[model samples]
Target: MESEPTAELIRAQLRRLRLAANLTQEDFGKQVHFSGSQISAIELGQRPFDRLFLKRADEVLNSDGLLLGLLRIAELHRQPHFLRPWLDAERVAQQLRCYHPTLVPGLLQTEHYARAVIRSDDLLADDEVERRVAVRMDRQAILTRPDNPPILIAVIEEATLRRVDESFRGIMTQQISHLLDCVQRGGVLILVIPAEVSVHVGHAGPFTLACGADGDWVGHLENHLGGATIDRAEELATLHARWDGIRSVALPKGQSELLMKEVMESWSTI
Candidate 1:
């Protein structure tokens, strides 16, 4: 098997190719339609380069698609090793069932909300936060993809909708509004487990089960340290039972939307 490309490897190749072509960063940037500083940041590994930038750079550097190829392999390995399996399953899932007691499901989170959530850790540097946020936003594509997007049934606790981050004013409102928008757009169903039913199985933690096209299900469980991909039959069965318990208490689609709107309005007042 071919080795996955590393960030350092890509950066080194870019610098070497530019030097070999006898072109300064400024000159190369001109050809690639990027600013010299932007190119500098990419070469220095200070900025994350997307596919478009890599393709343009490859063309300008005459790398014969080398850079683009590296980017494709690098992206597949960019996510944390622990998450790669679950991410792979998520992309091809036919349906997803998720339950969250503390925050919105990652698949439905807006960029701003995602950034705030990742930043809450306080241990990660700014760049790491941005990177994780980008990965999360990318994962959301499965819901909107034109080619058979997965149907998402997300059960979120009512408290999650009302939780406020005083530091980030109006973040909750924007997030809740985004959730409402997602439901309106189709392929997503947001169900709220009202606070009145304070005790429930979902209160144990958050988990997601991805149902593949063939009807096989894989489960993912998360915690502060990291997460685990669960495929064992007994574990999957437990997850399915928990999901049913959570869904049983959650408000139906219509009531959930109304509840979200009420919380959003309350947030607007704060």
Candidate 2:
């Protein structure tokens, strides 16, 4: 006798099977006639775990009836918990506005890129590294839900795009390619702040604004140590204003994707 399936449980099993099969979300999505974003939404529990999705996931993973069976469970166990408030806000956010000056936001990171970032500190054990990476990847689902995905408008620094890491040859290629695909897919808007811009309010730090369905909004900040959520309307309003300033300095989507393509092509030569 299995417990009823909750969103979390279904997402976990889906992620596990996908990882075990060594398939990227894009590749997995192709097999099921779904976009990578849609697959991501299902895996992150941002989208509903409908039977149609279960049927496709079952076919794609070669899981037979395992996924559907898991969906029938009553209660599932929890995954490692961190950033409870922020994660909660993201889960129901109707709109997302962000400015990242240092690195690509977690929601847009490729698995390889994410793995590199996760292991950079060199403090976590192997298991811990895997867990953190998985959690971060799961958070990206907010951008891919089949219905009512939060409108994501992110402005990243030009330097952040050019910053090369150890995985330049393989991971960078994948990361840029994934970014390109996301941009072309149209669920999110990504802007790049050119290096030529001398000064901007974004110089302070990275921040994200998540607006919930009920019109409530929150500001989010995350760093190497940890992350927190801000619910004060005044504070969130200020963050929103800052984000507007950053976006004003950022390149338009067409130019940004063109820059991304140049970088993606450069990775091949490296």
lDDT of 2: 0.77
Q: Which regions of candidate 1 deviate over 4 angstroms?
A: 1-75
* Candidate 2 least-lDDT 10 residues: 72-81
What are the models' TM-scores? Answer: 0.81, 0.70
* Candidate 2 segments whose C-alpha is farther than 4 A from its true place: 1-82, 165-167
Worst 10 residues of 1 by lDDT: 1-10
Clashes of each: 0, 5
Query: In TM-score terms, which candidate is top?
Result: 1
lDDT per residue as tens, model 2, 1-270:
122356667788888999999999999989888889988987776666555577788888999878765653321134314556777788799988887788788888998889888888778897667656766766787688888888888788777767775556677778778878887888788888888997999989888888888888888886666766788878888888887888888989899988888877876776
Q: What root-mean-square deviation over C-alphas does model 2 reach? A: 10.2
Best by lDDT: 1
